[model samples]
Target chain A: MNADFLLKIDALSVSFGGVKALENYKLSLPPSRILGIIGPNGAGKTTLFNVLTGFIRPDSGHIHFNGQEITRWEPYQIARLGISRSFQNICLFGKLSVLDNVIVSCQIHERTSFLSALSKTRAYKKNEKALREKAWKLLCVFGLEKHADRRAMTLAYGDQRRLEIARALATAPKLLIIDEPAAGMNPNETQDLLDLILKLKEKFNLTIVLIEHNMNLVMQLCEYIQVLNYGRLAAEGLPLEIQQNQEVIDAYLGDTNNAGSN
Target chain B: MNKNKHALYLMISMGLFFCAVYLLDAYGNHYYQRVSNLMMIYVILTVSLNLSNGIVGISSLGQIGFMSIGAYVSAILTLPPGLKEHWLTGLPHWMSTIQSGLFPAMILAGILAAAIAFLVGIVILRLQGVFAAVTTLGFLIIVKVVAENWMTVTRGGRGISSLPTYTNLWWTSAVAVITVYVVLRIIRSPYGRSMLAVREHDLAAQSIGINAPRIRLLAFVISAFFTAVAGALWANLIGVVSPGSFYLWLTLLIIIMMVVGGMGSVTGSVFSAIGFTILLELLRGFENKIAVYGISSIIFAIVFMLVIIFHPDGVMGDREFSWDWFKRITPLF
Candidate 1:
């Protein structure tokens, strides 16, 4: 019931046929804060995101966004309410041009009717021009302007990741959730992505909730952090506190350390 | 500035197309004129089907159903009241007394077909891939069965014939031009972009606020409207309406044209429809000389197999024929 919180989830639970994917998950996020959800593989990090974005219906829960209950809203409705996300796997419109990928996201806010588009009315033309310019500017931000006309699938791996983020940003979302933005990046590219995320947060005044396996990026970027283990909230605190919490380290961070050593 | 330049090029192309059609109408033999008219109708069918199957990535096998609905609706409406009363004695008083011009009948036919598509799409568009394709094929069978059994309205399998020959080269060409223009405009618009996104990845599209089901339904309904209009034109041109004509064979012909032309390319669909129609006519001539039955179908099947083997993405592969391509090739010539 906190009026200042931008997103509130309470008593959220979802289950597959016999196994729980998420159980009694809760989050209260204030505006303009970066929250990181870190967990081991199969720890339900993505399942939580799926529920929050309305891609999956919770078995039992309540979600309030901007003071409106959106527990049962459709994915597009949730997105239009100013929540946008990038996928864990790269999911660009493979056959569409790089510019077109962003333009399609920008089109969520388009006001012209199909009739106007068919007739090429002045309003439709102006709106279309504005959308194109906005998409082009976004591509420019990602250093993709040179490849705007190329199909998205033709881009190199890192560029495709950047384009996904650019496409997500084009929706003008208040809450941006990116999953594993540094998954396949080299150290140099990861550094650039870290800087880009910080810059975008400042430029758009965004509330970002990201799920990352890269601990260094998570620790540097997140103001608050939550840890999940076996579909339950294992720890929630400031980044420094979560880094030192014994249960979280034993449940998740220890695995990363062991892997690094090996 | 570039947008205006492209528009100018489109206008010039349309102008040249009409001039060519006019020359054929004035000087070509009746046989060639009729074949060209049929080609225009197939062009409309192929392009409209491409919107659903190619661009939206929804494989629909029910286009012939909508076409049949269009054909029957237009035929019943435009048939002279005296002829209707004499031929179809089971018609209701209101239906038997009504006689309309070709234009209004065709428009009504399209509207009716779109309405049916809207209802049907709500239920079936939820299915994806081959399931959706099979459901649409079932829809075609249902429509065919209804037409065959509804003796009062459709006169059953015998069909309505010889009432009028209202379709000509002008009507067919004008409608075909409008179909191409409208589909092209749609492909460049926001809605078109959404459709393409949904086709690429449904989850990604939904994440970005593109309503996947709604976008798919829009494509289906618009495609059905145009297909229905083409059906109306075909019925008027041939001066007959039969359930048998709107079945699997006709569906296969239109689908072949779409597949060979490249599913997602509008220009590909147009050229392929024209190319295939002419090829079929030439094959028919050969069939007549050899006294062979079903030889044209066999040849086309082989041609389709060859195209699939060598050029699986069709002639266009989601790319349009741009003026730049024309310029690039001019040097080689």
Candidate 2:
């Protein structure tokens, strides 16, 4: 109910075939803050991301963003309203060039009409130039400029992950939801990704919600952490408090020795 | 400097193409000219179909439905008032008396097809992959049934004949050039990039703010417009309009051209259409010489299978004919 929050989800619920995926999930995210949602497998973390991005409609809920209710909005509409997301599975446009993948996201903000594009008018040319430049700069940010013309599917797994984030950022979103960006990365890549995410947050002034099983990443990055167990919020607090919470430890974190491995 | 070079090359190639067309029109035999005209019509059909099925990855099989709509509309409008009264007695008074030149009739045909596509797209664009393809095939069947049973307007299976011979080599080639230019322009634009995104991954596309359904619908409508224009060209060239002509055979043939050219490639469609048209004609000649019926179709089927098995992505594999490619090949020559 706080008007100052950037994203507010209240009493959100979703079910599939009589099995509740998310029940009464509530979260209030303020502007430019990083919130990490951690849980064991089937903890409804991705379900929450899906619901927030409008890929999955909640059974009963209200999601307010920037003082506007956006419950059950279409994914593209939500995206156009400055909510962008990257998938848990690297869902880059496989056949398109790496630059084109970013350019496609950049196009959502273009002012050129279809007619202008067809006619190749001055506005369209200028807009296209701007989009290419922006896409190239984004690629450079992720160290992907050298592979701009390569097909997205041809990139290395780590690079594909970076490109997915770059493509999501190209949308100029106020809120970015990334699902397990560090899932398949080695320690070095994970560290690089951690730094990149932090830099992107400051550079883009973005409010981020990430679902991560990487405990190190969660501990190091997130300002606020929420633990979900069995489609319910088990704990919510600062990272240090989350680590110490006995219930969270029992439900998801487990013993401190095995926590990082988990 | 690169842009200017590309433009100069384009102008030279176009000049060469037009000169060839002019020479053929002036001196080529009637049969040769007609065959060339047929190639252009097929080029239009394949390119338009490619916009939806190849680039947008909708895999629609209803392109011929739009073509039939165009053919019937253009045929009716361009038919002389006297012929309309004599043949289409069930027509309304306004329709029977109305007259339109070939250009206006073709334009109207394209518009009508696009309108129909807009409505049909709303319902079927929600379907994906094979489901969408099957639904569009059903749309084609529905159009055919209506064209067959609605004897009042279409004159049923007997068809309307003796239309104007307006689709000369010049007209067909000009329209084909325009179709290629417009389609390629679309494929290169931001909108086209969105279409490609939608084709590559529907959910991923939507997450990045590309409305997959809307993009599919736009591609469908534009494709329908061009397909209808091609149908108009065909009706005029053949001097007949028939529901039978816009059926499964033509649909399969056009799809084959698109597949052989490489889906998601405009230049591929153009080359494949032209290549297939000539190849089919030569096959027909071979069939006639051997007095063997259905042999051409068998050969074509084998060729199609080979292309699918070996190349898999078709001859062009989604790569357009670029100046770089031209430069590379020219050195070998």
Report the poorest 10 consecutive residues by lDDT, candidate 1 chain B. Answer: B324-333
- Interface RMSD for every prediction, one decimal? 0.7, 0.7
B33-124 in candidate 2: lDDT tens per residue?
A: 99999999999999999999999999799999999999999899888889899888888999899888779989999999999999999999
Share of the reference A-B contacts seen in candidate 1: 0.89
lDDT of 2 at A13: 90
- lDDT by residue (A99-119, candidate 2, tens digit) is 999999988876567788779
Query: Model 2 compared with the native: what TM-score?
Result: 0.98
Using DockQ, give the best candidate's number.
Answer: 2
Steric clash pairs (candidate 2):
none
**Candidate 1 whole-model C-alpha lDDT, 0 to 1:** 0.92
Model 1's TM-score against the true structure:
0.97
TM-scores, each model vs. reference? 0.97, 0.98
lDDT of 1 by residue, B150-185 (tens): 987898898988758788888999999999989999
Candidate 2 scores a C-alpha RMSD against the true structure in Å of 1.8
Ten-residue region with minimum lDDT total, candidate 1 chain A: A253-262
Residue-level lDDT of model 1, residues A1-262, one tens digit each, is: 6789999999999999989999899999999999999999999999998988999999998999989899999999999999999989999999999999999999887766878989999988898899999999988888999999999999999999999999999999999999999998888889999999999999988999999999999999999999998899999999999988989989888755567676
Q: Chain B alone, model 1: TM-score?
A: 0.96
